[model samples]
Target chain A: MELLDFARGPALQFALAVFVLGFLWRIVSLFLMPRTKDRSAARPGTRPALFAATREIIRRTAPDKAFGKHSLFALVNGYVFHVGLFIVIIGFAPHIVFFRDLLGVAWPSLPNNVIYAAGVITIASMMVALVRRFLNPVQRLISTLDDYFSWLVTFLPVLTGLLANSHLWVRYETLLAIHILSVELFLIWLPFGKLMHLALVFVTRSQIGTHLAHRGAQI
Target chain B: MTREINVQAAANRFLAQISGNLGAYMEACLHCGHCADACHFYAVTDDPRYTPAYKLFPMARTYKRSKPPLSWFGGAPKVTEKDLQEWEELLFDSCTMCGRCTMVCPMGIDIASIVAASRQAFVAAGLGPPDLLQAAENARDKGSPLGVSADVLADRVEWLADDNEVDIPLDKEKADVLLTVSSIELMKYPDSLVAMAKLLNHAGIDWTLSSKGYEATNFGFLSGRSDIAKIMIQRIVDAAESVGAKTVVIPECGHAYGVLRWAGANILGKPLPFEVVHITEFLADLKRRGKLKLKPMGDAVTYHDPCQISRRGGATQAARDLLDGFATDFREMTPTGNHNWCCGGGGGVQAMSRAAGLRHKVFKLKMDQVEQTGADTMLSACANCRLTMDESKEHWHWDKDLGSLVEVLAEHIDESNAAA
Candidate 1:
């Protein structure tokens, strides 16, 4: 009970603070950083640049025609874990209760069983992705220590949350505290590693989408 | 003893090029391995070194070093002279800046642009393919990268006009459109320029090739020398302004049009006075205005999109629209439009002796794509692509003929509709 209180109170607060500030700092730096300007007159596209850029946040969820079967597998498998993680984070009742505690706002949540299923799928998909990363030459070549660490931090929360929900591997209170702590670890590490892609994927993607628009094309 | 580049200056050059959300792109890459699939270099070689994102490592390191927490942690250990030396091939030979990876990235990171930045750093370190570097010098010193001087251009223009019996105007002042010819067409594929003459004549567009700045291909762009690229492009801009031309038509060269349309004003740090259009785009505009009458080309033809012209330049439909105007059987590559594969010889690969093996190997991937189309002739707008494919087509004993899109249209052009 004491561990749970510490995890929920101080650790969670500290992690959230770091996460928010770090994310903003990085994002702000990116926008504020000296970027090359296209001073040339642009050939207008089908729509405005900003609109095309914004559309890419949703547009990049699927692969284009150039991506082959193996690439398709990697992309589709990525979505499985991403969608699962989204459900577990946003739809799970306990996670929403946590959010409500933080923000003083609440939303309807999914059934516990559904959350459990999502957690399981997320963990499984993440494991497969990790395995692919280890085996795939390109991924292995480019991956850094941060990638593995980010994966660990992200995986621990899902694994611990599932264990807590199932009451299988550890005492319920201990597992619950560990899950929250793992989530806090993920939050703290998020902005420092490639996990920052959660925010930056949209930033860089929109830059291209809008860039293509300026040159008279769509994403 | 080996000469060492000033690492500090190269690093600064790398830092300067972190433009257009490059900081975010460096941050956002998931290293998912999908980018490798999109690269012809990696696809052909199966070498991890050819991975598109892998090539951006030095630039990414420089970017991270400039930022906060990563900066504090060893400052990502500044990119070394040796690293630049090593990256010369990766930045130049192995990659074409084709932008297929840019189209395919889930993060939509413009990996090609980042690679180009890396090339700039390579250039700052005096490390790049010798032919490209020499050509950049030749372009500045001589009139053309291929050494087609003003005298040479005049001689070629006169010879082609007399031989073909076509009115190839040169250095005419006060023309409406200032036509810039690629050195490739001036030297190797003169037929494309003749074809352009025929098409432009048919459309009745007031245009003249400039003796002052006739060469369109900018080797500086391939060598990553912005100074030289600006100089090369400035020559054309000066010619246009001198003539009081309303528009400039870039010949059938990919990066030539790309430099003019996209990067010209940005490189010059001012807006161009007139419009810049690719020869194909010029044709498409003529067709749209019902200026040029055409007959159907009774052959199974397919179009290859030059990387800089279509994928990066966004004049994708221009060539296709022109093809549809004449080609009775126009079969597109499986993944056509902005998603086309590169000819494997772009970005100065065709000029490098060391990269010939890899360049030839990568050409197979393009050959396979072309083979699948099964068109009797494969047509492309850029002379560089046409030449590269023509060489490879001979190597593979490809039955399909390689042709310039402009030449094909000229062959089928209805001379009755030509301007008086």
Candidate 2:
């Protein structure tokens, strides 16, 4: 089969199946695990714990004031990469067309130039993050194979997508096929690797906030 | 030869202890190492193994093995007896279970709570430190981790009553407050008891110390054994209930307040019959209501926020408010309040002799923070923190006077209020 045909048909189907079924199974089994009951009394006369949880979902994404200066590099690059990726994935015109075609939902898209700029910035930030992970001793010590693998899988799609969109160094159809394949690989790896943070960031942050707030902490 | 550790049993125990929050924290950690700067152990020692996220490695590995999708592949690292041994040092000795790391984590993972669960797993594997185990045993059987007997408490109370010409009420029925203290205070600083008695007498509040439950430190909570913590705290609950007291006053011991304030309800499986208040909060409330008056002291004093009382127990504002009321030159530690660094000796680390060298090493961070303020007096509400600071002072050969807020207040009690 041609690379384009393989990427468009069987590979796409397989990636979607793994992504959907893997996520469903992971989340279900996680939620099904026996959780110890938090019998501690809630803080007296404050907003509900869920409100605190929601607030923290927004609050913790930014650097905490206490450690903000020390963590500025990570925070800035992390936010840039994440926001840039969001725009590239959801707001770009071509991606919106794909989404609308696949799922019958649509939103207004950013200009092509703006999408290109965001993609470039995202790629640059990912490069900085990868270099820091390899160079910084502390980060290096804590990093696992899963961490490096996830970074590579996540970084490739954006790179290949940008190359494909620019139609550089390859035929448009061939580059698009490679980009799609890279994205499929990322999707297949998402539920099983550190990339699971996409779903777990909310779960973990909110849980921390709810518990702390119930104890009357101001987090 | 190393004693055989049941790796399967340890993994099961860890999995069983997994709360929804813990599971989410394990899965969500980005391994960014941002929490390293917040941890005193890692910051002072620059040891990567002491990094908060690194400390959670074994438990996270075990969690992944239990998790699906990944579990199907079975590629997650296996938990071994050797891994548990190394983790015992990482979780119990090096890390103090301080929540500073939790405060700074962008992912908002409560790494400290996860460390506590890891300690529980260590205990389940029969690998908890002997010192902590003995302390828990003492609290379980002897009623006090320090082995302070009921007679010793009675004797101390009698001595304080005679020395201060104040009525020291013990086991009084139907008091308004049941005052409890740590054995550390009783043994190392009985003057804090004197201060408490004099203040309570000055306020004209009905309070008594119970011989049965006056010991406030809960080693079970520190050791991560809920059953033992429940037993230790229930003695106080029964004492307060028996006296029909409206409130239980936890003294300047941070962990005491932590156990009674945060974990009290959960241990009893219901709301505590009475209100639990830290002395700082209680005193601050009285001052806010104009019920207690204090004479201002003019010396520059910095207050060390205890991890349990301020960060974990929500008493930061009260301690600051009380300090504002009493000290004319109150200096703030950089990163004070809930973000304060620990004194390197909490979460039962103070009791573990094996952790002494590491504890002292981590304490350099707190020492430098305190020194930066250039304050002559360092005051904290937690007795354990005060004890740790005192040791730090001696180790570093610093001349700062380590003081307790309760005793400081006692020294400057408004003479007019005393007459009232």
Task: Report the number of the highest-DockQ candidate.
Answer: 1
Fnat for candidate 1 (0 to 1): 0.72
B53-157 in candidate 1: lDDT tens per residue?
Answer: 889887787788887866755546567777777777788989888888876788899887787777888788767787888988999899888899999988998
- Per lDDT, the best of the predicted structures is 2
> Native-vs-model 2 lDDT?
0.85
| Model 2, position B278: C-alpha lDDT score | 91
| DockQ values of all predictions | 0.70, 0.68
Interface RMSD of 2: 1.8
Clashing pairs in 2: none
> Which of the CAPRI classes, incorrect, acceptable, medium or high, describes model 2?
medium
Q: What is candidate 2's lDDT per residue for B150-246, written digit by digit as tens?
A: 8888988898889988798998977999999898998898889899887777777889999878889998988867789889888998999899998
DockQ metric, candidate 2: 0.68
Chain B TM-score for candidate 1: 0.96
In Å, residue A119's CA in model 2 sits off its true spot by 2.5
